[model samples]
Target chain A: MRSWLRSEDSWAVLTGLLVLLLGLLSLAGVNALGWVPKANEWTTPLKAVSPASKAFALPGGVSVLLLYTSLLGFLCLGAWRMGHSVKRFAVGFTVLFAVGYGCWVLGHYAHLATTPNKMAEKGITWGLGLTSESGYLLALTAGLLVGNFFPKAGEWLRESARTEWYIKTAIVIIGGVYGFKAAEDVKLTQTVLVRGLAAIIEAYLIYWAVVYFLARKVFGFSREWAVPLASGISICGVSAAITTGAAVRARPVVPVMVSSLVVLFSVVELILLPFAAKLFLTDEPMVAAAWMGLAVKTDGAAFSSGAITAGLLTDDPAQQQAMGLTTSTVKVFIDLFIGVWAVVLAVVWAYGVDRKPGQGVPLKDIWGRFPKFVFGYVLAFAGLLALGLWLTDPVAKKAVKEGMEQADQLRRVFFVLTFFAIGMGANLRRLWAEGLGKLALVYAISLFGFVIWFGLLVSWLFFHGVKPPTVGGN
Target chain B: MPDDKRTAEELAKQQAEPLLPAEKWLIFGSISLGLALLGVLLWLTGAM
Candidate 1:
């Protein structure tokens, strides 16, 4: 318990919670702490001043971008101060922030390049539907390229490339965003929430177990590698891999390995799933939607796949709309699995698996093993939801929405930083090492062969007859 | 003496290692599935 609280994960969670709490409170006009980021004060929408100018047009000023980066950098500096000189840490953090910001800007440009309206202004068909997440991919790619080519620099810079810390904070912010979105449309959320609950159960009991067995029995992986790998493949990818690694007390390398595989595979699915859906599953589009929820691992990629799917097949607008909404809903709904599953894995590991051969673990050890960030995540999600529910006044709700949006900006920055750092942290050569070779093979067969089919089956099972809320539909 | 030392090291290593506690996780997995079901019920009834 002592180590658990003192652990960097705990500190990061506390940091994220306090940042979000203060920001939200400030929005509610309770900004007693003048230093805190006031609610709705984080960002402004893009200003469309000079109509023909080539600059960012979105809201939330660039100052917050700098503020969020510096604040997070110092928090990281505080987290790592024990390991490095203050001056060195500060300098390294500046470089890290500069690189991340550059990538974010480049990514923003890529988004603008793909926007339909922007492209139409140039007489180009903006077909890709790429969003700001393109920046995350660019960051990851750049980080990997740098890390692979310059091992010496990779080693040195990795001192500040704290990927896990950044991601956990983003996830907590997402909890708030999710809560607000869920409350924004209770009917839609409820529908997705109910059906999505069933989809997750089928995923864990069937998808997770099957993949786990494939890793262990077929590929001959040890238990530690296989468990986290199973969760990574079966559940929500990178986040699930990290959570499972912690629950099982596996070394950090295990989750890192599994996470790399997930990122690579998710991209592949992101590209292939949409085209595959349009070509084959257009007839039974909900099946494609469910398949998307089952197949696409991360939020960004799943959403991109939905966008692509919607853009491509235009035969039935009603069906396409349903497919798009269902795909996003099911995927977002699956994002909720991390908190609950982490709780389950924690109890199992502390009490059941990690006990001594002839010895038993104390009940309190569960506290140590349970991922502390999950509490921050769940509390933020539930609190935001309840707040949205209770504060029915339009002005109050609008204020909450603005604050949550600002928090979301913070979350995206962290996510972008995390992907870059994960790329930096990964040793590409080791990815193809002997053990991982088999791991890769297992991922290939399972993702392509089993996941797609089973996703379609279960999605059909639960959502076949349950069509989208379309009017005068046959 | 060396033999005894090796045995102690092995024991410590075993004690330190992750024990692949799949069964306990199985029980927990069931609990998670149940909670997911509860989520569905609550959402349907507008209690969530």
Candidate 2:
């Protein structure tokens, strides 16, 4: 039994199982506590406005569950023989965790009562409303930091077979949440067409043309590291950078630098963009939302910016909804393109880096490097949309809706977990080694470019006589 | 032992030189120009 368990394949299976189990148990615990209540009085009215009212419940449980498991996994990995430092882990986890908790606290208490029928019109509230999943996940991340510092307690929990089992279960269950079909259900119109096209173009140009030059030319980054660092800053932020780094076999330090810069810049954007909107474009909520959505690198920062913009424009419901929908939709559209962009970069890197007399990329290199799970994600979204369309029966539709909703909830949880893992993996020392000057330059250039492109698109689309309806007035 | 040595050699061989001093200034200039063009275009279009 000992020999069998000690085998490499056996260890892999064991670890996988541990991840899944932990995810499930944490999910169950979060749900049981009603820590994040499914039905809130505040969001009910907003639910009524939405075509899918039943799918209004916040997926906080999934978020918390993912957070806890991911943190646990990171701690476990850190505790292993790997050269993971406690101080580095603690620092990264603490900042991310605090941000998460702040979100949760804001969700639970902040009220959006300025508008009449405050419950139905799901405007941005300070404490908690529908999309507080991000907050709960953040809190879980904080808990991980606390747990990590207490090594004796962490060790006690780590020794247990049950704990291991739980973590593995959570990872597997997390996979079920990435429903491909839901992606198709997201309606695309003229607004989406323009935004989607802009996002894709901006992601590449900012990464290559702007951020790349800054990283290499200004900051004095080597080509090896500059590519991934710029890609991360310009594309979808940390995750995109990390994914691209892994695919291109970039130096570990590259991802660390990217993650640090991303986290720092994201926080800055969150604070600055809302103020910029209020000060500069107070009368133009749609333009403000569009600018925030396009300029901000991360979804969380964009959402935060949108929420602040909504708060500023509380007197106008139509404007508030438009702002909220536009920011969320644009961010989601950007998220959807992460896989495609990664693939394109992977192909580029193969030819550019791996093909020469001394270095030759394999034929199967791109396929091997590509993130296959994204295919599963796209497939699940497409499959569900097909089901939703083909099955005309109300009962069938209801079931599909429920399934998709659950999947979305699960997806949120996985994202939280992934972020937690990312935080765990992150270390400032690694980032310092990569140098800061280049990263700073890249981020500045990218932001500048994004602002201009996004602003142009908004002006072209809505500048002329497009009197967007004022809140509650139209 | 030979394989490990060969791998190390290959890794060392793959390392590219960091950006040159002139190259740095050129990149900086290009990025600045791009950003300026974008900003001007947006301003002209009444986006600001």
Measured by lDDT, the strongest candidate is 1
After superposing candidate 2 on the true structure, give the runs of residues whose Cα lies further than 4 Å from its correct spot. Answer: A1-36, A39-106, A110-195, A243-249, A271-293, A298-355, A362-373, A394-438, A448-474, B1-48
Q: Enumerate residue pairs that collide in model 1.
A: A27-A39, A43-A60, A44-A59, A44-A60, A45-A58, A45-A59, A46-A57, A46-A58, A46-A59
Alpha-carbon TM-score of each model against the true structure = 0.68, 0.53
lDDT of 2: 0.46
lDDT of 2 by residue, A1-474 (tens): 644443222333344333333323332332221222232323343321111123335454454444455555554453342334545545544444445434443343325232333534446434332233334335334435534465444333223212112222222232232222223233322343344444444455443556677655555566666766776666666556766676566766666556666765665565566667777776666667766766676544555566566656544544554565555545555556666655655555556545445443332543433333333323333444454456666655444444434433333333343334333322323334322444555566666655446543643454333334553344
Candidate 2: chain B TM-score equals: 0.54
* Candidate 2 chain A: 10-residue stretch with minimal lDDT: A160-169
What TM-score, to 2 decimals, does candidate 2 have? 0.53
C-alpha lDDT score of every prediction, in listed order:
0.61, 0.46
First chain TM-score for all predictions = 0.71, 0.55
